[model samples]
Target: MKRIYTIALLLASLTRVVAQEAEQTVSSKINQVAVFLQGAQITRHASVPLKAGVSILTLTGIAPAVQQQSIQVDGPASVKILSVSFRINYMEEHKKPEKIKLLDAERKRLTTLITQEKSIQEVYLEEENILKTNKSIGGTEKGVEVAELKAAMDYFRQRLLDIKQQLMQSERTIRSYQEELAKVDAQLTELRAIKGQPSGEIVVKVSTKAATTAELDVNYLVNEARWFPSYDIRAKNVKAPVGITYKANVSQQSGEDWENVTLTISSANPSEQGVRPIIKPWIVGYNNALSRRTVSGSMMTVTAGNEVHGKVMDDEGQPIPGVNVVVKGTSVGTVTDVNGNYSVPLTSDAEAVVFSFIGYNAIEKRLDKGSEINVQLAPDVTALNEVVTVGYATSGDDDSDDKSRIYGSSAQKMKREITATEVIRQTNVEFKLDEPFSIKSDGAVRATDMVEYELPAIYEYYCVPKLEEDAFLTAKIMDWDQYNFLEGEASLFFEGKYIGKSILDTRNTADTLVVSLGRDSNVLVKREKKKEYSSRQFVGSNQKVALAYEISIRNKKGLPISIVVEDQIPISNDKEITVDKLEDSHGEYDHNTGTLTWKKEIASGKTELITLKYAVRYPKGNRMLLE
Candidate 1:
């Protein structure tokens, strides 16, 4: 018996060894194959051989979204996969088996209890129906024979109460079973998820056309595992219309699932297009201010074929009349009339022209090709140096050698010499009257009997600057009243042309005369007054009279000047009259015919006052008067 027992033990030990060897062979083959998780392209090779009893695998960088049983070995394996265990944390994998085992036991316990609760509820319903039937029989018998009925009622009541209590208890047990069943279901659902294998490396490709640098951050999760891809793309000496792409290969475990994958690429140059080019004008002048001139007036006209025309004014901006204008060098020039305009011809050879007037500075302008030219002339304070107006003519001492001399008598001088009486006679008188008279002892005279006379006269004279003639003189006296005395009749002549005119008129009683000179000039004036009267004494008695006279001279000049006045008075008395206040006064006086003589040396361009007053008495009845 001992021998047979030993042999049987040997056979049993041999069978156990064969089973262990088969399990090892299956695990080796399974471990040799790569495992891949759902949603991940990378495959993971086993670090350690998987045995036939193994139900879980730990992986790095694996996706969490992998489904249970989704993990598969790509190569042949001996054992089929029955279940998969998944865990977010690697350490949780170690406890997965125990948790799954406890869940299965709880599920079995709940299933058994649920069946027992359902059977007890059925029994409670049957007892409730029996108690109802007993109550109905008792009510039908009324008070007849209740001895055994009480016993039956008591037993039925007890059984009914017990059954109701059991039913209530069953309901509570069923509720607790349902709660346990829910917990088990949740555990089963969690355990069904497949754990992904680790993806050791991955490959990433980036493409761009910008001439700049780029950087990328890629984050991926596989089976609740996370991985980050960090890289930078740099471009050097890159030009436009050029593109490049970066490719990299990274390795990772195969069973990892990709989740929450974020790939971001940032570049240094953000623009997709190139830049373009720009262009600006030239300016000139000081302070951007322009110099301008204007020429204007009535009698003058300014015309420039290709030149600008404008108005001319004085320093105070007042228009000046009769201005002389000329070019700078050449003799191309013209004079401004009363309107202050001059159309000085431009010279083709001249580069610039000068504009000059009597009291203004000469202005020069460069000849521009434009049709307009404007210039401004400043005031010339030294205008007295050229063509200054003297007593009766203009002196050319101040002019340049090439300039023509301005020779003309001033209107003031000629108007002053011609009296109002002469002008009236020239305008109105028909026949000339000539009578000689002499100074008397008392400076009084009587004229012979003559007819009454009334007549008007007119006179005019003109002086102009000599341009061609050397010297000339002319005179004319008209008849009748056709030529009457009026203002602005006396004209001045220098050389031969008229420069200006003077107006002379008599006062209210045809006694006092006033003279108005047009232009500025020196003047010399003369005036005469004469009167005649006659009377016969009774019988042969002699007649005489007294005469009184006053003479005054007013000089109008800045400096001392000279003035001479001569008077011829007719005298009838033989006795010589004595003159008074002669030397001490303005001039010497004559008392022979009551005639007074005044001579004075006045100042230059100034008015001097000369006055003479005297009285004379003649024989009674002898008439004495002035004519």
Candidate 2:
């Protein structure tokens, strides 16, 4: 609803002869842009010349994605806005910037100068070549005196040198002109691309009692804008607090430039059709042949896909939660649950699936006629290296069997000029940008700096040589909720060195947030199998295997450190399989999961060794995954 204020003006009695009708086109400047997770609203200010009665003023250069009802027109009390309307002009041509004419003129001048420079250089080169080609000067001119022959030779040589110098100078000028022309060509190309897009207009009819200049603020909602949080977590050392560089990936394709406007990014989507959806009645009836044509609006339908289930693990074989698993060449994917397990449907044409996480290297694995794939992602050192790009991709209907060609993305990252402050809205969060920014009509993702924090934490070393050879360092932060972090990606830097990428999953987190700091080489860890005590034997109709392993850890650091050593034993699911006498030396054993954990504080320069032993008995002819 458009709100109009009816305030009386004391200076003038409202006298109307024939009502003065006028039409004025006003150009509005985008003063503020409120970007959300789903949509954006642009607030523009344009001052218009007003008569006493009614004037229909059109606000030009609007986006076609505007929701008509979301338009809000505000002005002073004396100016009563009568009606608001929107119209999309598809056939209307875009007006190129007047500066483009000046640019084109400069480009043409530079190009002409380059051509003239090249022509002069060519003539100089031709004359120099002709003079150099004549080597019969002495033989053809034998009648000439010796001093005159020497003078002729010197004169020819000087002319050739002079021509060469002229050519060199022309070549330099040509190169300069060519460089300037290239820049102008790029500018013209950009402008031309923008000149072909569609535009809309908003018309506002205002009735004022007297002639005055009226300031109008118009706001409208638009789609194709979003913002997500990204982080760069840096730890100078175990003793220093972690420094977090909070940033935002803001993106938009609002069909116009935002200009030097104050930008606000929000996690809330006001454009979303609110909750409390009406439940439609479910009718269950069998149709004879209609089942074959089940697609509602499509003429054809084909559903062919295979489900891929997998677990994502870290270097230590620890389940990594919140890892993204997507099919290659498709946006269809899902994230790993708290148990580090994901199940995504692979289209029949999909050859592989890519597993990605914040600090882990993304790996694409081929299906190879297998439904279960367990992957171990190595840590990528460039994980939190500072990304200035933003966008979102999500899985659509698996029943969509249309084998459309996957096109390459021409999308560019949107860049914001200033940082923002987070505001707590009624339903979601909003980040108000501190400085102004401008984004093009093309859908590009840009980044903006958000906030920074110094987090306090404790660091520890953890090792599980049974699964991985390396020892990993981890940081545990208390009261992580204070950061108000949403689920997103983060880059980790340990000891001022980039370790890898990791996820900031607050979904299933406990009171403390445990972040992996990547593998550590300074700590000493080793795992050894004792061949003397390990053997396989067949007793009666049963086969028996005995295994013994030793793990050693040393504290080589200057300060005492706490370490957690982990090992595991196999569990049997078959009735005939039996396991007995599993012993963990100086560690606690979990019966259900067959896990062993040893927590110890080792003094500087101290070494500790732990032993683990187990026996397995099964049928003679059977083989298990253990071997």
Candidate 3:
């Protein structure tokens, strides 16, 4: 009976102990609640609020042994048993450890190779220097034995070459090592990513510990959808100048949809005040994974003007296609057609049309009342002259020789004058020798050598004058036609000082002169063209007739002064033609009416007219007269 009582009491005690153990709750507190289920340590707010009844907690980077163990949570509620599970990132653990070891070994090997390569390169440089020093010493000392010195030089040279070769090999090895190291690093990074995190398993635990229970809810955060505006504007060649239409396209990635979005287009640089918007915003949505929207309006009128036509050509008289023709102040522009012709409307009152092409100087012309315009672009001779001529010539027999003479003389004179100015002028002239001139016995030349010469000369003239008082005038013959019509430039001087320069081109019937004057300069006297006689007219016996012409003068500065007029004509036949009505006053002549007149002092910027009239008759049978 004593043994039974003892056994019963022991059993009761053991049962009580077991019950107490069961009632005791185990709980844990994670400093960082959110942990990756793989190799990385992380902190994520619990999606579901932790409660006494049930909760899920995912843990990461936990030891494999600990992952399989049960986790208990003790809270201020009834004891509950929560199912638990384990997650192991086996691939991450296996790959990262192996890659780390390999990368460390490779890095060490590359470092050693680089260091050795540098040392070898230094050795080569030192050997080369030694060879150079030996050669220098051998050159300075004449008493040294030639053979010994030669042997020494040969030894050093060979040693230097060997060192260089070794250095090269070392450099190659180092480069190869570096490449291997890079590949190893990439492999290691990939391995680390693969071994990083396991995307499986969720753990839940419940404990009888004293912790408050709360209702749990889950929510997710995502990026919101928004609209971004973008546009591209361009203009085409048209008679009516059109303003740019700004178009906007919207794109979104997030699944949320947008509505009632307004887009506004405003010019950052408005040409005029109160310009209205052209593009209005429209609704758009994503289609087939692409978000886009296009908005267009009526053609905005930025500028409106009459249509004008023009031809573009280079200095060599060749038409240039695809030249850009732009209205100066606005974006309205067009390129020349295939025929080097462009027609564009004017954009602004102050704007000038500019014709620009590569390899040619740009030409700009201001819009006026005229509809027909011509633009001649100069060549960029400042860069290079592609064609040049060098030859000899004499005075004109039929004015054909005069062209070559002009080019040669101009080249020589330009070279001399270039010293006085900073400008360097280069002239390139080309003459085709398709027809050669010959001296015939009878002097009856073939076709009188009436050659048609097309002069395509390139002139690169730039000048930078030093003194403030010094000035220069240049007039280029922009156009020419007849052979007898002479076009030349001349500078007029007063009291050893240049006043102005004039470009004169005259036909037998009419004369046109354009004059440009320097500051504070005045023209007092008139210059005129000589009268031409009729080829069919017959002169009287011993007849000395003079035909006179007159020029009008203008002053642009101070009050004009009285100036004398002088005339001289180099007649082909001096005896047959004589001066009759020699005008001793200011110049005045009329080729059509055959009249001459004269006037007195001209005011500043005012014209003074002069004229002279004379009758001229050709001597009979004086057909061989030279002019």
**Top candidate (lDDT):** 2
Model 1 has an lDDT value of: 0.34
Residue-level lDDT of model 1, residues 1-627, one tens digit each, is 999999999999887555433422111111111111111222333323433333233333333333323343422233333433333443322222455577788899889889988987987897788678656544555763577778877888788888888888889889988877865764453343222212222222122222222222222222221111111111111110101111111122213222222211111111112233254333556665343334433222322212333445456554444333434433233333333344443333435655544224767666554424444456655421122111111111111121111111111111211101222222122111123212111101111211121221111111221111111111111121232221112333433345443222111113322221122244334231212222223323333232333333334435333333454445444663322232224444455554445544445555443333333444454444433
lDDT, model 2: 0.70
Q: Is candidate 1 or candidate 2 better by lDDT?
A: 2
| Whole-model lDDT values for every prediction | 0.34, 0.70, 0.38
lDDT of 3: 0.38
**What's the residue-level lDDT of 200 in candidate 1?**
29
| True lDDT of residue 463, candidate 3 | 16
Task: Report the C-alpha lDDT of model 2 over 306-422, residue by residue, as the tens digit.
Answer: 467878887878666656576564434556665678876544455677776534577988766478999998876742212222222221112112122111112121222236777
Better of 1 and 2 by TM-score: 2
Q: Which stretches of candidate 3 lie over 4 Å from their true place?
A: 1-96, 138-142, 192-203, 206-627
After aligning candidate 1 to the native by TM-score, how far in Å is the CA of 215 from where it should be? 32
Candidate 3 residues 64-91, lDDT tens each? 3232222332323354545555454454
TM-score of each: 0.20, 0.61, 0.22
